[model samples]
Target: MTNSEQHTEHSEHHTEHKHIVEYGKYLFIWLGLLALTGITVSAAGINLGNWTIVLALVIASVKSLLVLSIFMHLKFEDKVFKIFVWVAMLTFAIFIFFTFLDYSFIR
Candidate 1:
C-alpha cells in the first residue's frame, strides 16, 4: 500500500472517540486495590510455612492484574495485544515454576 493508504488505514484503526473511564469505576478499583493491600499485609503476619509464599504470590498476582488491566489500559486494548501479553505472562510463569521446581530439588 502507498504511504497515504497505510496512514489512512492506521488512522481508521485508531478509535476516533476516546474511551473514557468513569470516575466511580476508578474509585472502586482504587478501593479494591487498597483492600487487597490490607489483606496482603495481614497475610504476611501469619506463618503458613510453604503455603505463605503461595498465598502472597496469589494476592500479588491479583493486584498486578488489576493494575495491568485498568491502569495499563489492557482492558481497552485489542485482542491481538491481549493475546501477546498473555503469552508473555504464560512464558514467565513457566520459567518461575521451573525455577521453584529446581529450588525444591536443591535441598
Candidate 2:
C-alpha cells in the first residue's frame, strides 16, 4: 500500500459519501421559484401601499433560502458553514433595516 494508492482510495471513499439531489426535486424547486415570482408580480399590482414592499421582500427571502439550501448545497454542508450563512443573512437584514430607518427619518 503506497502513499499515492492510499490517498486515491481515501478520496474515492470520501466522494462516495456526498449527497446527490435528484433531478425531480430540482424541477420542483424551480417550479416553486417561478410561482413565487408570479405571486410577487401580482402582489405588486395590488394597492397594498407600504405592505406590498414587505410582502415582496418576504417572498424574495423565501426564494433565496430555497436556492441557497438546494442549489448551493448549503444544506449538506457543515454546521459552521450554515452558521456563517445565517450570520451573513442577519447582517444584510440589519443593513436593510438601517436603510429603511434612514429613509423614514428623511421623509
Best by TM-score: 1
List per-prediction Cα lDDT, in the order shown: 0.81, 0.84
- Candidate of highest lDDT: 2
- Model 2, CA-based lDDT: 0.84
Off by over 4 Å in 2: 1-17, 98-107
Tens digits of lDDT, candidate 1, 6-62? 232335456333455688988889999999999989998999898989999999999
Query: What clash count goes with each model?
Result: 0, 0
* lDDT of each residue in 5-96, candidate 2, tens digit only: 22323354343235667899999999999999999999999999899999999999899999999999888776667999989989999999
Model 2: lDDT of residue 48 = 98
Candidates in order, TM-scores: namely 0.76, 0.75
